[model samples]
Target: MTISQLIRPAHSFRLTPVVKVASFHIGRASAFRATKTIENGAVNEAVVLPPKDKVAGSYHWDFERLLSLSLIPLTIASVVNGAHPITDLFLGVILPFHCHLGFDAMITDYYPSRRSPVLNK
Candidate 1:
């Protein structure tokens, strides 16, 4: 009558529905544990480096932290409602170009070229 009954045919070898549900729960729990283990390992590796003085009177930006923070919201949005085209466009296109332009401006200001007339004169 229904798709499930049609597929099973009252004689197939499929596990009891309860067993299938339990198996899925167990699989998810194992995956969560594995993910936590990997995250902890990465944190330990990052902390193993020797401490250094603050450059430019501030701490260095940890790209790992930035990436993790960014991914959390993106992952939630994706899981809840698929990929948003506007969000993807901003992140994949606009953000990178903005960061690059900002970095280029900072570098040009901080490291003037000797070949430039303004710098030579």
Candidate 2:
């Protein structure tokens, strides 16, 4: 079977409100109430699936796979090409921002109890 045929056809899925909030925080923007839709027919599900009955350690770290699959190269090309130091610095700054936003969103969603103080008289 061809690669296209092997993968599931494009389907629509909606993120839950919690995930939407997380995404917004990661983007460092105000969360919107509108429904978001992602349509990508080019996705191959086989590429994402884990092997059956295999231990987690059986698979190797896929850093190259992840970098190859990401849009970082395009972003670097568009924003910073000549100056590697500037590009590295920019990414260093942005990475923490993205990480903190996601962390805050997840904590808010999953750990409401931790956010509240238990006042002991």
Considering every candidate listed, which one attains the maximal TM-score?
Answer: 2
Which residue runs does candidate 2 get wrong by more than 4 Å?
1-83, 114-121
TM-scores of all candidate predictions against the true structure: 0.27, 0.29
Candidate 2 lDDT (Cα, 0 to 1): 0.51
Candidate 2 per-residue lDDT, tens place, 19-69, comes to: 344433455345555644333345564446667765564442253234333
Cα RMSD of all models vs. native, in order, equals 21.1, 28.9
CA deviation > 4 Å runs, candidate 1: 1-82, 115-121
Q: Per-residue lDDT of 16-108 in model 1, one digit per residue for the tens?
A: 564444434454555665431212354457556657766642332454346446756765676787778966764675456556655755666
